[model samples]
Target: MHGPLKGLFAWRFVVRAEDDVRHPDGRASTSLRQGVRHQDPEPIVANFILDTASPHTKVCPETLIALRYNGDMRPGQSATVIVQGVRTPCVVGRPGEANSIGAPFIVDGSLTFYFDHRLDAPVLYVDDENADLRCRAYR
Candidate 1:
């Protein structure tokens, strides 16, 4: 197993756009598409997953807590999020829900470098300004 990420991991990246999130329970019942979801019925912000192969960001519980999106959680909840100019779908879940990384908001989806294979693991970047989320591979 890889070592745990304690400190010295945070970056700045804006939420380019919100995408269509899908889950096994079907599409999440939300109306957030493009920009941050301010009045989400259950408002949420989280660290998303990123890989050299993927182009979208994923959400984490801490991010959710940071964004304040606390409500029913379902697996396979996909969202069509955008980063830079790439539009990709983002999946959602709870702590143990499907695709659950067990780490709340490790990458806020906007920042890439989650699976760089060069570092140990992904790190969560919590920006003080507006609690913006982001991710970056360890150097």
Candidate 2:
């Protein structure tokens, strides 16, 4: 239920910053709150452009510039973006860590887009066990 997207169109879509984290007291956190380190409502939802040529997924340069990123995108250095969405510690990254102007992934570089031209609807397979978001691109 997550791949083999077949079509003849440029790839692009909106990828959401998952609200998968919970606070110590079991609260959901998102960027739509205040007092969080990177409190802002604009980044929770952003755009993803398919670019198989680049080596790894990266934030849009301008977005990073706007966030004034200073090595915050480094490995093992996550921030507490929205410390409290509804009432917990969640949300991560700056304003541009999710956008991909070029590239697809860094640590998990297993995504590849192929057009078989024989299927319908775009699909995304998040291989959680293997931590892979590998998928075929479509709309």
Report the alpha-carbon TM-score of model 2 versus the true structure. 0.33
Native-referenced Cα lDDT, model 2: 0.35
What is the model-wide C-alpha lDDT for candidate 1? 0.37
Instruction: Write candidate 1's Cα lDDT for 1-139 as tens digits.
Output: 2144223233333333332345577866433433445543333333332233433335433334343333333544543433323333456545532122212233343333343456655544333443342222210
| lDDT (tens digit, per residue) of candidate 2 on 1-139 | 2233222223343332322345579985542223443532333333444445654444443333333333234432332221111111112334444443333242243334445546653343333444322322110
lDDT of each: 0.37, 0.35
Misplaced by over 4 Å in model 1 are: 1-3, 6-11, 16-30, 33-50, 53-57, 61-73, 95-139
RMSD to native, candidate 1: 10.8
Q: What is the TM-score of each candidate against the true structure?
A: 0.32, 0.33
How much does each candidate deviate from the true structure in C-alpha RMSD? 10.8, 11.2
